[model samples]
Target chain A: SAVISQKPSRDICQRGTSLTIQCQVDSQVTMMFWYRQQPGQSLTLIATANQGSEATYESGFVIDKFPISRPNLTFSTLTVSNMSPEDSSIYLCSVGGSRYEQYFGPGTRLTVT
Target chain B: GQQVMQIPQYQHVQEGEDFTTYCNSSTTLSNIQWYKQRPGGHPVFLIQLVKSGEVKKQKRLTFQFGEAKKNSSLHITATQTTDVGTYFCAGEDTGGFKTIFGAGTRLFVKA
Candidate 1:
């Protein structure tokens, strides 16, 4: 099991403002992913942050909107650029554990007004 | 792209009643994982099924993987108030790093 933490647990941002969420894992992990959960909706994968190199984003998400930086094995950052009211959701960072199980952070709740 | 679909978007069950959620995939999966997210909480991993036709039990919860690896189910026997949450099934494809999650089934328990 891994202990994962996310900074700025809850925040309210105005439109057009960007919020960068940081994820720190207690131990080194090979795979890290960013997910978004809208109000009354399911989890949507934004991108997969690799230890090095570029992150792999999902089809509906783009790097220009959600840029991810994984500088090391135990840390990563996801920046929501030019945020809109639609971007208001809970952003979660998860690490793949043994046997394909994923341990998730407490998640950063963002409300854009 | 792989897609996973879950049935019964919402369920209302009385306390002590049983509840079940089904997950179907468009593609065969290497493994399927179950997660539970309480209201206003993040998702917590429950278990993962890797073998075909495998069934695992944890307390009152039972998870089953289909022989085709394209479907799975989670059944909770004698649910409690703590069982109220959204259940998600995530399927991982062979040789793929991405895991696709189902839309999830929200369980509402009335005590």
Candidate 2:
């Protein structure tokens, strides 16, 4: 099991402002992903943070809105740009292990005001 | 686009009773994973089923993968207060490009 940690467990920010969430894993992982989970809803994939290349985003998300940076295998960041009330959600960092199971960070709860 | 549908959005069960959640995917999956998220917590990996028609057990929990690899189920025997949480089923497409997460079934256990 990997120990995953995310910065700013919870935060409140003004609309139009951006918030960058950081995720650190205890060990190196091949797959790192960012997810957005709305209140009382399921997890939605934001993007796949590749180690050295551009993140692969999902259908409803784009790099402009959620810029991701994966500097190395054990660390990554997700920045929510130009946030709005609708963007308020819990952002989570996940790492996939050799078994294909995922380990998740505690998640950053962002509330756009 | 692929979609994974989960049923029983919410369930209320008495302690010591049984509970189950089902998931079906629009596309065939290479594997299915189960996760549990306690209230105000992150989802924790519970188990994964890779083979078709696979059944795996962990303590009081039983998980099943459909023979077609397009659906799955999780059953808990004698639910306890500790079992109260949202259970999610995630399916990985055959291409392994992405994973589709189900809507999740929130379990409420009354003591």
Candidate 3:
């Protein structure tokens, strides 16, 4: 398993504003992903943050709304653009550690008012 | 996309009693991993099952993978108060590192 640290454990933002969350892994990893979990709901994949390239957005998710950046193997960022009340949720970052093992960060709780 | 379905959305059990949660997938999986998330905390890895009909134990908890590799279960014997939280099952498909997480079963252990 890998140790991941996410910044701004939580934040309160106004609607129409933007917030950027950062994820840093203790060690180098091959793949890093971003996921969203609404209150009392299951986790949903937002995008795959790839190093030195554009992120891969999942179906029903767009890059314009959630821009992701992976500058290196151990760091990545996800920016929620034009926040809305519906966008208020827990944002999580996960990294593929070893054979089929995924490790997650503590998560960032975002509240859009 | 693969889907992992978890059953008994919520479970309430008395301490020292037993509890179980089941996970079924639409497609066969190469491996399935279990995670436990305490209230207000992130999901933590518990164990991973790789072979068909495989059973692994961690103290009072037992995990099993179906013979078809499309289902799995987690059984806790003598449940404790510390067991209160959500249990999730994540599956890793063959030849893919992408993991699909189940909705999870919330467990409530009462004294």
Candidate 4:
């Protein structure tokens, strides 16, 4: 199991601004991902953070809106660019387990107004 | 696109009562996993079912995978206040790493 931590537990951001969330894992992992969850909704995969390369984003999500950077196997950052009210949600960092089960971080709650 | 459908989006039960959540996938799955998320908390991995018709138990929690590998369920016997949370099931397609997550079922327990 991997221990993951995210920064800025909760933040209230103004619209049109941007916020960068950080994720750090205790152990090296092959797969790291970013997810979004609206209030009382299911999780939606945002992107896969690939170390030393561009992130693989899911459909409906783009790099211009959510740019991700993974410097190493255990660290990654996600930037929510040009935030809007619709961007208000919980951003989670996760690492894949040996059997594909995912371990999640505490998540960074962003409230864009 | 793959989808995992969950039933009874919300359930309210009294303490000591039983609770159950079910998930069905449109495609065959190689494995299914369950997770629990408390209010204002992140999702925590609970268990994973790999083989068809698999049944696993952890204390008061019981998980079952359908023979078709396209469905699963999680049942809690004598539910407690601690069981109050959202339960989500994720299904991974055969030979694919991409997982489809269910909408989740929120269990509310009254003490």
RMSD per candidate (Å) reads: 0.9, 0.7, 1.1, 0.8
Better model by DockQ: candidate 1 vs candidate 3: 1
Clashing pairs in 2: none
lDDT per residue (tens digit) for residues B7-111 in model 2: 999999999999999999999999999999999999999999999999999999999999999999999999999999999999999977688899999999999
How far does residue A79 in candidate 4 sit from its true spot (Å)? Answer: 0.5
DockQ of all candidate complexes = 0.89, 0.91, 0.73, 0.83
**Tens digits of per-residue lDDT for model 1 on A62-84?**
99999999999999999999999
lDDT of 4 at A43: 94
For residue A85, what is the lDDT in candidate 4? Answer: 98
List the TM values for chain B, per candidate: 0.98, 0.98, 0.97, 0.98
- How far is A93's C-alpha from truth in model 2 (Å)? 0.4
Candidate 4: tens digits of C-alpha lDDT, residues A1-113: 89999998999999999999999999999899999999999999999999988999999999999999998999999999999999999999999999969999999999999
Candidate 3 local lDDT, A27-113, one digit each (tens): 999899999988777778898899999998888999899999999999999999999999999999999766666788999999999
iRMS, all models = 0.5, 0.4, 1.0, 0.5
TM, every model:
0.97, 0.98, 0.97, 0.98
Q: What lDDT is reached at residue A49 by model 2?
A: 96
Better of 1 and 2 by DockQ: 2
lDDT of 3 by residue, B1-111 (tens): 788999989999999999999999999999999989889998888889999999999999999999999999999999999999999999977856668889999999999
lDDT of 1 at B97: 66
